[model samples]
Target chain A: MRDAYHDELRALTGRLVEMTRLVRSAMSRATTALLDSDLPLAESVISRDKDVNQLCEEIETSIFGLMATQQPVAVDLRTVITALRMAADLERMGDLAVHVAKIARMRHPDSAVPAEIRDSILEMGQIAERLVTKTGSCILTQNAELAQELEQDDDHMDRLHRRLFRMLLSESWEHGIEPAIDITLIGRYYERYADHAVRVAQDVVYMVTGSRVGE
Target chain B: MRDAYHDELRALTGRLVEMTRLVRSAMSRATTALLDSDLPLAESVISRDKDVNQLCEEIETSIFGLMATQQPVAVDLRTVITALRMAADLERMGDLAVHVAKIARMRHPDSAVPAEIRDSILEMGQIAERLVTKTGSCILTQNAELAQELEQDDDHMDRLHRRLFRMLLSESWEHGIEPAIDITLIGRYYERYADHAVRVAQDVVYMVTGSRVGE
Candidate 1:
């Protein structure tokens, strides 16, 4: 019975990894669709969001069922709960990507934000994606060091986020309000995406250490 | 033994409620400090944060003890885990309030952020405080309806957050980067405080219904 319970927990993670993979793909596509100004790619990114959202719901259902039947504890319980929260982060990250895609569609072969801004944003996406994968591996391997390292990476993303905002606000002051709003939201999306990645690492740290990080 | 485990579970919740109260008070002080641009109040908020952080760690230790000694399961496990996560939320909410207070200290006497912005932020603090209290009340009583109501209130805070950001960003675009940075951080503090309030309500809902909200 213990083995079966462990098996159920492992299977829960399998689905989460699959969900994580899909969401990261969506994030990359969303960024590409926006930065490259590809309307078809934007359309696909938006359409694909529904799938990630559905997977999130499905995972929630699965976790609740596993909790009901197996009733996990210690590492097992932490794993299930952390996976559930991470799934939400992935879904939101996916939505941010879709949001970026929408911006691409709005421009339709022209960049809504300037090329320099787009480069920073693409850089932001890459940072967040790397953190997501890092935490994913850390949790899978139960490696606390890898998870803790993500905090530094998250700090880097935050610096980039602030810089992007500072640059945009300055540029918009020279330009106008319309561009300012677009730029601000883009800055926000990247900042939040990075935040979710930080959250994933935090969960992993808590799971392994039995102590919440930064507390 | 099962009854004893349940009691320990309930005791863990009682401790959580205490920490919740402390964190909420810190939030209230932090908000006042922000609006009044009170340096002493801001410093006090920072000093008081240690109390909340300590309580969070203490609660975590207690729960770990319970899990280790009692080996709780099913609902008992859920209760402890929820308590742990909620502690983190409460702690983070304290940080948000401190973030607001730090901004106040940055400017001194009066903020670069406009009075209108300050008033809007005060309004945000009030709504968020109510939500936090209601979440605590709901958890104490296992009231899922109140949890739902708290979430609905979050939607209002969300709208206000968006409205504040749009106004502040537009206003600050005419000025310079620093003011916009201030407004943006303020906007973020409100948004995240509201998010923590929602998270508390989520824990309440999960505790009562054994079902995830919005999932």
Candidate 2:
């Protein structure tokens, strides 16, 4: 029975890593769809979000079941709770990707990003993808230090976000109100996507260290 | 001992209601600050968010302690888990309110909502407050049916959000790209605040009826 409990606990961690990978894929595909005006790719990302959600639900149930049956104590209990929080963050990351995809779908055949900001959005997308991929690695390895490093990585995304905002708010912006709204929201979406990844990484840090190191 | 456990459970519900009230006040003050260019009020809202966070931490600790000590089963176990989810939702709601307040602070001495869209923004704020107030009542009463009603109230906020978008996207929109971005984000902050309240209400519905009523 004890061996079975540990197996299930390891499975919970594996499931979290799987969800992170799925979120990474969704964000990467959504970014590509946004950049290329690829409606099919956007639709694919949007539809695949359900899979992420289902996995989150499954992981959550498994976490609860482990706690109830195994009565995990000390670090084991914290691990289960932190995984629950990480699953929520990953699920939101998936939803953010879906939001990006829906924007692409909404502007089908036309890039949601204006040409002037497309380069910056592309960079932001790459940063988001990298951050999410790093998040998966952090989960798989339980590397708290590496997980803490994602915040510095997020600083790069923040700089890009500010740059995007500067361009939008510049006096010469001529994209009109509609594109302005789209750029503002899309920039925010990517920033927020990175934010959730950072959050998940923070939880990983806490889970491993048993200390609240990030705010 | 069982009676003490039940009392602690009631106290957990009370703490959730208190957190909801804090979030409601934060949104209200943040809106007023935005509308009136009141930097002081905005600062106050921003500072108060810590109180909400602290409450969430306390409530979460209480929940884990309750579960670990009581080993609650069946409905009691579900109640504890649902409360945990609600605390998270409430904390995020507080953060959304802080985001609104920060926007007000960032645009100090100038209203964030342009005159034309100010009315719609104000309406969204009111709807957000109303929804959160209803969420508190739902928790206190465990009214699954009333909790379900907050979504309809959310529909009202959604329409207001759409109306704000139309105004921003209109050909006659004279607000510059900066104000447009500000309005778009501010509108989203309020919309998300309402969305969180709806989530709490849905959790209440689930806690009461043991039915997954909303997605």
Candidate 3:
């Protein structure tokens, strides 16, 4: 009994790491879709979402199996349950990135955003990529400081997001439907991606400290 | 052992129901804050978030404890895992409501928005309230179809949100900065509330059908 329980715990951790890797790849691909303005890459992210979603389900299955079979206690239970929550967060983060990729398709060859937004998207992508990497590390190592860093990273992303929105709303923008929609969707995607990264941090904090981490 | 497992499952269900109640209340308070422009009510939602956070932690502890002890397999594993994911989604929905309340403090009492906006906010509140209720029911009954209804409702909210943003961005009027921000924030909150509601529905589908539902 003890051996089986131990094995499931280890497997649960393994599955979580695998899930995080899928998120990292998906985020990376989605960002590539944004940067290159490649609809096919964007579509691929949308297609590959199933893999992340499947990983999430598999982890959930593990947690349920652990409960029914192992009946884990205290910290073990926390770890398994945390795996479930973390998988959900990661899956949603993938979805947010895919949404960003779709929004990137908002531009036409002749209708690219002005220099101001193009620059902001470039900067925003860099920050988001770094944050995703750090968030995965937080999960892999259970590093609370890395988790804590996500809040600050999210703040930076929010600032960029606001700047992007202001640029869109500023008098400088040429009044057009498609360009405006692109900006709104872009803002929503970046804002949500940061929000998910924060959730990843919160998950790590929950797993490590077992304390309520306020958003 | 079977009876014990059943007892544990019952207990987890009870806790999930309780968590649902807290989220529903949080959403309710947020809606009141929006319609009445009640900053104090919003503050209450913000303050009560600690309670929501505490409840989330408690649920995770409970589920993990059950899993560690029972070591259940297959379908049972899936149910608890879904609960963990649902808890986080519900908690996030609550935070979005608190965000709406925070934006309320920024609104100007004397500045008048177009009549269209007033109706839209009112409509958003009603739609938001319905989604919250649907999510609560979905969680309790594992009602995937009812949850699907909420997904369609989200499309309606999205359309309304797009319309609101268009009006806000137009050069039509001299509404002050605070009001503009307030409206922007409120529109965003409702849109996201609908998004989380869809997430909850997806979870319900997973639990009921054992297949991940696509958005």
Candidate 4:
């Protein structure tokens, strides 16, 4: 029975890793769709978001069942709770990717990013992808050190976000209001995507170290 | 023993109400700070956010204890889980209020919203306060109907958001990039504040109806 309980806990971690992978794929594809203005790819990402949502619900239900049956305590209890939180973060990241895909779909043949800030947005997307990939690795390997690295990775995205804002706010900005709004929202979407990755990594740190990150 | 479990459940509900009150106060004071450029008031809101964060942690810890000791299931289990989610939403709302207050502090002695969009922001603030109040009342009373009303209330804020964006993007916009960025972020903060309210309300709906909302 004890081994079975541990097995269930391991299964929970496996589900989280699976969620991380799906979310990573969603963001990578969504970024591509945004940059290439590929409507088909955008639609695919948007639709797959439902799959992520479904997976989250499944994980949440499994968590409740595990907690009730195994009655895990101490580190084991924390692990279950952290898995719940990580699943939520991953689900939200998937939703953010869907938002990115929708932007791509909305603009259709034209990229959501204006030409001036296109390179910056591309860089932001790359940072977001890198952040989530690291998040996946941290979860799979239980490498608290790699989880800590995600914080520094997020800083790079923050800098990119500020630079994007600077370009938009510059007096030389010639894009019309529509493009400005698009850029602002899209930039925000990517920034938030990175933030969720950091949150997942932080939760992993708490799970492994038994102390909240930065506190 | 069963009665004691129920009592503990009631206590959990009370903590949620307390969180609601704290988040409501934070939003109202932060809005005032923003509109008045009151540096002291902004600082207060920022500092008090930690109080909200602490409360959420306490509540979460208490919840884990209850679940582990009581082994609740069915409706009781769902209630605890939903409270957990609500506490998170409330904590996030408090953080959003801090974001608003920070913007105000950063541009102290000058309002974040330009004159043209100030009224709209003020209106958004009021709407946010109203939504949260209703959310609190719904939780206290278990009024699922009132909880459902928050969705429509959030729609009002959405329309206000769109209108504010229109003002910033207008050809006649003369507020320049700095003010435009400020207005954009402030507007988003209010919008997101309302979104959290809706999420809390939706959680309430699920608790009462045994159905996820808008299915």
Question: Which candidate achieves the best TM-score against the true structure?
Answer: 2
* Per-candidate interface DockQ score: 0.23, 0.67, 0.29, 0.47
| Candidate 4, superposed: residue stretches over 4 Å from native | B1-4
Docking band of candidate 4: acceptable
TM-score of chain A of each: 0.90, 0.97, 0.90, 0.96
Q: Could you give candidate 3's per-residue lDDT for residues B1-215 as a string of tens digits?
A: 87988887777667666766776677777766666767777788889988877877787777666666676567777777777777777778778877777665445243223444778887887888787777777777877789779888998999999888777767673553434555666787788888877887787788789887765
| Better candidate by lDDT, 1 or 2 | 2
lDDT of 3 by residue, A88-172 (tens): 7778887887777666555523334545677788777777777877887887788988887888888899999888767766776
Candidate 1, TM-score vs. the true structure?
0.82
TM-score of chain B of each: 0.92, 0.98, 0.88, 0.97
Enumerate residue pairs that collide in model 4. none
User: Model 3: DockQ against the native?
Assistant: 0.29
Model 2 lDDT per residue over B23-132, tens place? 99999999899899999999999998999999999998998888777877667877888898899999999999999999999988877778888788788889999999
lDDT of 1 by residue, B1-215 (tens): 77887787778678777766876787788888877777898899888888888878787778766766675567776777678778878888888888888888888887757766767788888887888888778768888888889878888988888887677546444555566667766777878788887887788788777788863
> Which structure is stronger by DockQ: 2 or 3?
2
How large is the interface RMSD of candidate 2? 1.5
Instruction: Kindly report which residue stretches of model 1 are placed more than 4 angstroms away from their true locations once superposed.
Output: A37-47, A53-92, A95-112, A140-145, A148-152, A169-173, A202-215, B169-177, B212-215
lDDT of 3 at B117: 74
Worst 10 residues of 3 chain B by lDDT: B105-114
Write the residue-wise lDDT of candidate 4 on B87-160 in tens digits: 99999999999999999999999888677787898899899999998998888898888976888899899999
